[model samples]
Target chain A: MALTRDDVEKVSLLARLQLTDDELNSMTEHLSQIIQYVHQLDEINTDDVAPLAHTLDITNVLADDVVADCLSREAALQNAPQRDEECFRVPAVL
Target chain B: MSSPETQPMGGTPYAVVVGLEVHVQLKTNTKLFCRCPTTFGQPPNTQTCPVCLGLPGSLPVMNRHAFELSMKTALALNCTIPYFTKWDRKNYFYPDLPKGYQTSQFDLPMSEHGHLNIFSENDEFADKQIRILRAHLEEDAGKSMHDEAAGVADSRIDLNRTGTPLLEIVSEPDMRSAAEAKAYLQELRLILLYLGVSDCNMQEGSLRCDANVNLHIDTPAGTIATPIVEIKNMNSFRAVQRGIEFEVGRQYTLWQKDKQVLGDMPKQTRGWDEGAQVTRAQREKEESSDYRYFPCPDLVPVVVTDEEIQAMQQQIGTLPASLRKQLLDDHQLTAHTSAVIVNQGLGFADYFLALATAIDDSRLAGNWMQGEVLRILNEQEQTIQQFKLSAAELGELLKFIQSGDLDNSKAKDVFAVMIESGQSAADVMAELGIEKVDSSQLEELCQRLVDNNPKIVADVQSGNPKAVGALIGQARKENSNVDPGQVRQICLALIEKL
Candidate 1:
C-alpha cells in the first residue's frame, strides 16, 4: 500500500518541512502512485521465494589490525558550519 | 522458567519478543549506487557528488562493486538471493538527506531467509540461533550533529556520510531475552566483518541497531499482547541490551494493567532515552508504514546469475563457523578453546589455522597463539601481520619445543625475544646463547656442582630435599648451556653417593 495523506502530512511535520498545500497534495499523490507500482512485487509469487539480504558472497575482509591514526580536533572540525575557538558550531540541527 | 510471560504494550501476561533490524555499512572502497567516496569522518560534503547529493537532474548509477559485495555477504549468511532484484525510492524527509527521499530496496531486497548462530555467556543458556528475515540495500543519510552547549541549542549537519551503501538486515523476533538479541547482533557483526561486506562500525554509524520489541503472553484462553515498541538511537551493544531490557519491563508493566489498552493487532514505535533509562513512545507504530516504494527507473535491476552466485560463494573463504568446527576435531583444541580462536576475526583465525596446518599440534598452537600471540598483538596495539611472527615462523618455533631444542621456559624466552626485535626464533636461541648443552657435558657439570656442595647432596640423600632444585639452578648457571632435565638426572645420581 502507498502512504496515506495523513502519513505524508505527519511525516512532513515531523521532518519540520515548510510544505505548501499543493506540494503536500502532490507529494501524497506521487508517493501513492509509487507505492501502487511497488505493489507489483505482490504478483511475483514469492511464497517459495526468500528475501535477499546481501548481494556479496564473500565474508570477512578485515583491515590489517592497525591503530587508527587520529586527526586533530581542528583538522576534524575544519569544515564545520561554524567553529568557535574550542570547537565546531552550527545552527540548531534538531 | 516458572514465571508467566509478560505481554508487550498493554495486554495480558506476555514475553518480550525482540526483532532487530541491523544496518551494516559495507566496507567497500566506494559508496553504494554512486561513485562518491565512502570514507567515514571525511570532511563535510567533500565526498558528495551529484547522485549522492541528490541534486536535481543527476541520474543515479549503480556501483557494481557494491552490489557484488552485497551479494557475497548475503550468500555467506545463507540468505537466498532474488533472481531479479531492484532498488526502490524510500520517501522520507530529514535534515540528513539532501534529497527528500532515500534510495533503498523495498519489496524486492537483495537477500532473504538466512540464519545466524549466536553464542551467549556459558551458563544455563543454550547457544541461540536467530532467523534472518531479509537483508536490503539502501543509502545512508547524513548525520545531525548537536551543539556541545547545554540544552538542544544549535546543531550541525554533516553530509559526508550520505549515500554510504548500507545493508539493513532484519531478523525474526525469535530472541526471548535481550541477551539473545545482543548475542545475535554480535555474531551478525562478526559474520559481516568476516565476509568483508561491511565494516559495521557503530561509532561511525556504520552498524546501528533498531529493535522492534513486543511481548508474547500465554493466557487461559490464549496469549494476549500489547503494542510493539520500535526502539531507536542505541549507539552500542550495551545500549541495545539495556534498551531491550527497559522495553521489556515497560511493556510488562503496561501489560500487567490491561494489555488491550494499546489495541490488539496494532504495533507502535518507541525511542530509547539513555538518560531516562526507559523507552519513550515515538508514535503509534504504523502497522505497515507505506513508504511508496518503487523500483528506481534510473538504475537497472541487479541481475545475478548462478555462476555469479557461485563465484561469490567461491570468494566466501572459510569463516569462523566452519573453521571452528574443523579446529575442534582435527586439533586437540576443546570446542570452547577453538571457538575463542575462531571468534577473534579471520585474520587471527587465519594465522592460527595456517600455523595449525603447517604444524602437527593445533592444541599447543591454539594455546600459545590464542594466549601469547593475542596478548602480544594487543600489547602492541597492532595486527597479527605486524607481530613479526609469521604463521610459518611461529610454527617453526613450536617445532623447536617439540624437538626439545627449547624447553617451555626457553621457548617463552625465545618467543619474547623474537617478538620484541622481529628476530627469528632460531637467531634468538643462538644470540641469547640458550642452546642446550650435550647430555654428557650437562652430566659432568651437574656432577661437579653436586661434589662442590656436599650438604645439599646430603639433604637430597636423607630425603630432606628441594636441595635438588638449588643444585639444578647451580648447574644451569655453571654451564648455562646445560639441559635442565639432564642436569636434574645427574644431580640425582650424585646425591645417591651421599
Candidate 2:
C-alpha cells in the first residue's frame, strides 16, 4: 500500500499535473496515507462475496436509438480555445 | 492453454504467436453516447455535440441499437454473454481523445470466451480454430489530421468520428503465421457482416486491426521467448499479413543478435511502414503510457437478460461458415464457387440462394452467377441492388434454358438485353424479337434443304452427321431468327426419311 515519491512524480506527469516540489512531497505522503486507508478492505475475508461494480442495482438502463438536436457549429466551437473555420487546431503532434 | 505450434522460416525453426485486436464501428444512426449523427466523411466538427465534445456537465447515455448490435455480434461469434457488464474509463491523453479517456469495457466485457475458425493457407494449420479472448464495446476517438498535405504546420482535430460506437474484439495468441492471421480476420469480418453488426469496411475506417506478435525460438538449453511487439498502421488484411511476416523475421534476427534482450525488453509498440513493407518501432516500453482505467461514473451498468440473449441468438441467421458448408454439402457446389457466392456479400448471397432454390439447380445457378451474371454486373458497374434482374427473372431464364426453350448463347443475349433495358426476360425477348421457331416451319425448311443439297444430304446419310451444320447455316441464312438447334434436329429427321 506504500507509495514512493517517484510514484507520485510519475502519476503527476501522466495526469499532466505541473506540481511544484513542495506539492509533490506532500502528494507522496497524502497518496500513501490514502492507499494505507484503502488497503484495510483487503484484510477482510470476503472470498464468497462478489465484488460490487456499481452502487445501483439496476441494469440495462439505456436510451432509445433516436437522434436529437445537436449544437450548431458556432455554439459547439464557442468554448474552444483555438479553432479555425471548420476544426479545432492543436500544436504540432508527432 | 493452447500454444500455437512452432513454424520454420528462412531455414531456421521459430514459433510465431500472433494475436489481434480489431475495432469495428457499429452501424448506428447516432453516436454511442450522444445525439450527434454517426455519419462518416462529414465536415469536420459538424457532428460534434456537447456530450461528444467532452464539454463540462455533459453525460453519456448508452445507445440501445449499439448494445443490441454488439449483442448480436457477440452471439454470432458464439461468445458467452454474462448477465451483467459495465463500462470503465480508459484514461489516456491524446489530441484525438477529447474526453482524455475512453469509456470502454475493462474487467467485464459484453462477451468473452469465443472462438473463430479460419481456413489457413499453410498446410500445417489449415481449418484451425482461433480462440477469441473477449469482445467489448467502446467509443471511438476523433481523428487528428497532421496537415502535411495543406502545407500547414499545425494539426487539426476532426471530432466527427468522436463517440462513434465500436466493438473491440481481442483474440488469443493462437495464430502461428501471417496467413492464419489474415484468414482469421477474413472469417471474423464475414461473421460481422453476416450479423449486420458493422459495415466492416477497412477503407472507411469502420474496421481496423492491430496485431500483437512475438517469437519463440529453440536454443541450446531451453526455449527463448522474444518480447511481445504490438504493431499498428496496418490498413488492410494484406497489410496485416505482410506486417506480421516482416515482424516475425525482424524479431527473430533481433533475438539472435542479443539473447539478453528477451527478458529485459518490455512490450514494444511498432508501426507498419506500409511503403517500406517493414514494421518500425514507434515507442519503447518506458515511453509507453499507462492508461489508468476505472469505472465510468456517468453511464450505468448494462444487464442483459437471459431472454434477451435468447432473442439475439435467434436473431443471428445462419452464419457464413454453415451456409458455405450447406452450399457445398447439400447443394453440391465446389469450394471455390461456394466461397465466391458466400463472399458476394449479404444481398447477393440471398439473391443467389433464392435463385438457386427457385430453379432447383444450385450448380447451374452458381455457374450463371459466377459466369454471366457476375461478368455483366462487373462490366456495368452495378451491385445486386442496382441489378435489374430479380431472382425470379433469373430463375425463369434458367428454366427456359433447362427446358430446351432457349440455348445458352441465346439466353446470354437475352440477359444482356434485360440488363440494358432493366426489363424482364420475357419483355426483353419480345423487344429483341427472339423466339423459338415453330416445328412446322422448321420441318418445311428441312425438306427444302434436303431436296436441293442432295450431296450434303447424301453425306449426312452416309454417317457424316457434321454435314448437318452447313444445312443449319443455310437455313439460318434464310431466316436469321430461327433456332439453329431446332434446324439440326429437323435436318436429321429429313435425312432419315430419305
Candidate 3:
C-alpha cells in the first residue's frame, strides 16, 4: 500500500515531528517504499509457522525484588534541559 | 426519585452506559524495572536510576515480586490468567514521561474475561455484574506539578513516582447508572485492599480512575447511540459518580439538539471540572496511535507455571466479601456494621474477631468497636495498630458490662482512661474509683435521699413520675457509681412506701 501525505502528516504529529511542506511529500514516498519492501513477506505466507515476538527463545528474564543505590538528586538532574534545585523543570504541562 | 422537571434530558429518559479504567499502584518495595525505592512524597528525583531515567544503553529487568503481585490480583479478581505473557511499549509524548513510551501489556494482558459483582448501595439494581475486559501491568510516569512555587512560569517534574509498578484494570460498559459505577469501584478497591496489593488511596494518587460514558436515546425512528467520551481528573469516588451523572445528562442534551451529532462524530476526551462540577471537552479524540509495540529486547516473556498459579491462589486467603458475609451470618451483625468493621483494615477486623471469640457477644463487641474504638481513633488520629487497649482487655471490659459490674456509660469513661494510660480495664477501673453499687447499698442510698428531700418526696407521692429523676441524681452523687435506671427504680419503691 502506498503511504499518503495525510498518513505521514498524522504520524508526524503523533511523533511530535515538525516537517515542511516539501519534506512531507518526499517523506511520504520514502516511507511508502520502505513499507512496501517490508510487506513483501506477506506474499510468501507460511501458514504453518508461528509468529515471533522476540528474537531470543528465552523467557522469564527476571530480577529479585531488591534495592540498591540509585542516582542522587543532583546526578539525576545534571543532564536535564531545565531543572530547579531538586526537580526537573519544563514548560507548563497539563 | 426525581421530579419530572428534574429528570434528565428534559424527561427524555436516556439510558447511560459507563465503563471504567482503574489504575492502582502496586505496593512493591522498588520500581518495576529498577532498584529505586517506590516511596511516596520523597524529595524529587532522588529515586532515579539509569534504567528508570531512560539513559543510554540502560537495560530493564522485570521485578519478580511485581509480577507475582499482579498474578495474585488477577486470581483474586476471578480472571483467566494466561500462561504466557509479554510486555509491549506504548508510545506517547508527555513532559512527565521520560522515556516517551510506557512498558505495558498490549494485546495479551495478564488477565481477562472477569466480572466484578457490585451490590448497589442504594440503587434499584440489587446486584449487578460489571464485566472486566482486561487487567494489565505497566509502569507509572512521573508527575508534572504546574505553576511552581513563587509564581515560577515553568512546571516541575517529580521522578520519585516514576517507574512505580502500576496495574490498569479495564471494565466493560455494563454499568447502567452512576450509582452502579460507584459501587463497582468501591467493591474493587475493597478487594485490592484486602489482598494487600495496593493502598488504593485516591487522595495520594495511589489509585486513579477514568470513566468512559455515553448515552442511548430511544426515539420513534430508532435508538441513537451517542459518541463515547472519556473523562479524567476525578479525584474521589463521589466525584466519579457525579462526573458520570453530569456526563450522562450532558450527552443526552447535546444529542437532543442535533441528531446528526451521533454518527461520524469522533469520540471526545474530556476533563472533569471539579470546581465547576461539569465535564469540559479538552480535545477531539485523535486517531489511534501506532505504538509500534514489540517485546523489549532486554526483557523476555514471563512464563507462569501451574504450580506458581496455585500458590498465588492459596495466598489470596479469604476475600473481604466472604468475611463480611461471615460476620453477618455467624455473628448476626448488620450488613452496614459488618462493612464498617471489614473496612477498618485487616488488623482492626482481626482484633474484633479475637474479642468476639473471647466473648460470645459479637454484636456488643462490634458496637463498642464502631462507637468507642473508632471515635478514639478519629479523635486521637490513631490507627487500629496504634490502639493501646489489647483485644483481651477490651473483651474483659465487655464482660464487666455483661455481668452488671459496669454500665455502658461508665464503660466508655473507662475505655478513654485505659487508652490514655495503656492500662488494663481492671487497673483503669481501680484508678478511677469506678465500680457498681450493690442493690442493697443503692436502696439505702435512695432511702436516705428521699427522706432528706421532702419536697421532692411529696411531688413523687403526688404521682409525678419524673420528680424521681432528682432523687436518682442525688443517689449518684452519694455513691458516684450507681446505674441511674436502678436508682430510679429504688427511689420510686422507697417513695411508694412513704
Per-residue accuracy of model 3 over B3-113 as CA lDDT, tens digit each: 111245346556777899999999999999998889888877889998998888899889889998899998888898988888888887778888888899888787898
- Clashing pairs in model 2? A60-B303
For candidate 3, the per-residue lDDT at B303 reads 83
- Candidate ranking under lDDT, highest first, comes to 2, 3, 1
Write model 2 residue lDDT over B429-473, tens digit each, in one string. Answer: 787777776778778888998899989998998899999999989
Per-candidate DockQ versus the true complex?
A: 0.13, 0.74, 0.81
Docking class of 3: high
Under CAPRI classification, how is model 1 graded?
incorrect
TM-score of chain A of each: 0.65, 0.81, 0.88
**Candidate 3 positional error at B409, Å:** 0.9
DockQ of 1: 0.13
Score each candidate by Cα lDDT: 0.75, 0.86, 0.86
Per-residue error (Å), model 3, residue B362: 0.4
Model 1 interface Cα RMSD in Å: 9.6
